[model samples]
Target chain A: MDIFNKMFGKNNVSSKTVAKERLRLVLVHDRANVSPQLLETLKEELIKVISKYTEIDNSALEVSINNSEHSVVLVANIPIRVRRSMNTVC
Target chain B: MGEVIVVTSGKGGVGKTTTTANLGTALATLGYKVVLVDTDIGLRNLDVVMGLENRIVYDIVDVVEGVCKIKQALIKDKRYGSLYLLPAAQTKDKTAINSEQMKQLCGELKKDFDYVLIDCPAGIEQGFKNAIAGADKAIIVATPEVSSVRDADRIIGLLEAAEMDSPKLVINRLRPDMVKRGDMMDIDDMIEILAIDLLGVVPEDETIVISTNRGEPAVTDKNSKAGEAYRNIARRITGENVPLMNLTIENGFFQKLKKLIGLRDS
Candidate 1:
């Protein structure tokens, strides 16, 4: 069954779909004039702001610009190492 | 005054020159006086594409530099009496003509021709600036590839920044069979991502190469599918309500077999 699934899988996406996905992401960045350097700086700033409330795994954080149906979205995925207590928050 | 439309693609080899040549010929066939200007200095090919290379006595550089009048630089088409070509200078670089000079030249041409189609050079540089300097409209040509679409997106932003709003798009060299097989980007995929008004879609036809080799446009061949597509595009440019051409390939015996085995879509 695994071999059959490998040969013909429902999870297999067409190359054009991959191309479309890539183009959507790239165009979102291109249209916003957001360079890789700008995203890097943005990631650092996001880490700085989020670090105040919790300890984050910076190495695992991912930042990117995605295109929604109507507008552009800034997506950030950050792993939390620890959450500050109420006394520490104050 | 007649309108000036620049045919441009940010990346080369995406059929800008071919689009310009075919559309110009098609429009002339529609009884409009058209002139094609090649703006790719130091790498001119529109003349060869139009089969008017041997008659180039003067070029755009000569006209802008006051060495020759614009009329002396214009080359009459071999077939279409209403079609003309302004060849580019092979020796001169893009710097030879500035934006202001191009604007004046376009103004002069507009007085005589019903449509002035400028074949723009690839990339976003001085040549591109010169190409769009005097145009009233812009047409962007892009293929189905990621690189072409990415560059086209950048070109769209640049065109908007230049105050040229609502530039139409032409998807060139699209393979319908590959698209049907889900191996290539479809028209909707391009239109949705680019988010621009589609002027037309030219299929991947070998006749375009043959027509270019013969120095004649595909629009002159009634049997060529690409020619028919260009005709529809020309009508659309003239504000006619022409529907998009059907791009479905005929399902044959092999196609039936493939579909039966779940290798092809229904």
Candidate 2:
């Protein structure tokens, strides 16, 4: 794809695109008044809460803010090891 | 009553003073009585930009501090009789006047002038607070860059929190050539990110520097494109429905042919 784009010169990912994408992500966090430290705290709390229900790989967890056309989302990718039954957890 | 508008930007060097000077001059040219208030106190440049720096007998500090009347402090423009400027005190800092005094001063100015444009200082500090204190409307000036747009977004958030009417945006210093080359962000990108109504877009022009050097606003020059943009913005402020100016670079025959033959991109 890179070679094809280089040959045809159809690369639309201009510097402006990169700037806009970066701005979109930054502003979502800005307008929401959520700092990077706050996000870190939220990630830690999420790991804590989810650990009771499932055996999850906290080291492999990822969290980020994704901006769509009309809305922003807090997306998390957590690697699950095993589901713990309520009786077993209790 | 006159309408008080604050020209502001969160970041420095974004043409806030130039916009205030030009828009005030344009509004005055439209036969409305206008007074430009320089609220940037110590770092005053609106006077220099408007070419009234040498004539400042008294500043905004004097007027607010009861040392001089507002009339005595206002310097009449050399060109337009209806246009006057209340210059900032070069010695005094932003703390010289607070929000309450600014509100009162704007209230008093509104009774006599048709428009009062407050040139706000850079940063989201006391100067910003004082500039927006008396404003009925706000115009956020920004350039089409990542830092400027981010600051503009932050300013918009601050304005909304203060319950000021949704501040309008003026995208300044846009380079059409760079935008065409995909090296700069276009108008739509800024408007989408800022999420504010665009007041006007001033193309990047060297004429602005020349006009500032001459201490005469570009709006007074018949040939300056930046001047024409400011005039359109003034008309829009008066509730006129002027369309955005065409900013496309006129292509020559060879360039057109090259684009037609797919040898070059638009």
Candidate 3:
């Protein structure tokens, strides 16, 4: 189910949903003042740090910039695939 | 000095001039001296829409070029005592004026009128720069289409960079029926995406066409929904706490029947 949702990628055939996704993606890039390549670099860096301790689902990472009434925020939501014990903490 | 507001949309044909015209007319009716300046230089429409086209002897170019006094170029509205229009030069294009000249004109107009509303041309270009150079506020108009919304978002970003704080949003020509059928975006969706204070929502009304053809704004009609929306917007501009006009689908019997039959009202 999760994988299917990922395949659909928070967007469906509905025009409204498509518009929402498009606006979100463009606005995130616009507000962060960074290219999409930078976001991929951030995702890679995040994976490198996390993979040292626990196995992670590198494919299901979501990094975006969202705006509020006061400021724009960089938000990261990466799915964890496995957890390692503290005995192997890095 | 008066308030200088720029009515702009990055996309064309989203009712920017109509909004400017109606707002100026409505504001004047509320007893404020308002001047509507057309900054769309070559493609002037404010004068025609305001029914003061023939009275234009001197235009914005003349005033900006120091060929005529600014006062001489302002044509008073025939219906409203306090409303005036500084027509754009039809012979010249947008390149005829620069930001500094526009700022000067706005400064001069602000001292005399209670509100100076500039009708901006579409696109993020020199004309847009000139329109907002002296503006104290911005009102972005856009239809509910995805392309329109996208352009409006871009305009908002540009306005923010221009240091024009809190540019207001006005979603124009919204069709409630389409929204209900899930074919179009609702007002909340637009407000969220644009992330701006929504000043007003003007419903799609055919009366606008009739009035525009007659060289009269529908704001004076009082019977049209779009007119009422414009009136509420005008009052809001005056610092009144007017509620947003409801443009929700009525869901009447015919509408329900159409829905049951999987048909939409044309």
TM-score of 3: 0.82
Question: Model 2, range B1-266, lDDT digits (tens) per residue?
Answer: 99999999999999999999999999999999999999998899998998877888999999999999999999999697699999999997999999999999999999999999999999999999999999999999999999999999999999998999989999999998779767789999999889899999999988999999999999999999999999999999999999999998877788768765767533
Stretches off by above 4 angstroms in model 3 are A1-13, A33-90
Per-residue CA lDDT of model 3 for B97-198, tens digit only, reads 999989888998899989999999999999999999999999999998877987898899899999997999999998887776556788899998887999
TM-score of model number 3, chain B: 0.97
Off by over 4 Å in 2: A1-12, A68-71, A83-90, B254-266
What DockQ does every candidate get? 0.82, 0.83, 0.36
Give lDDT tens digits, candidate 1, residues B137-183: 99999999999999998988999999996999999999998897677
| Order of the predicted models by DockQ, top scorer first | 2, 1, 3
Write down the TM-score of every candidate.
0.91, 0.91, 0.82
- Give the proportion of true interface contacts each model preserves, from 0 to 1: 0.89, 0.82, 0.39
Candidate that beats the other on lDDT, 2 or 3, i.e. the better one: 2
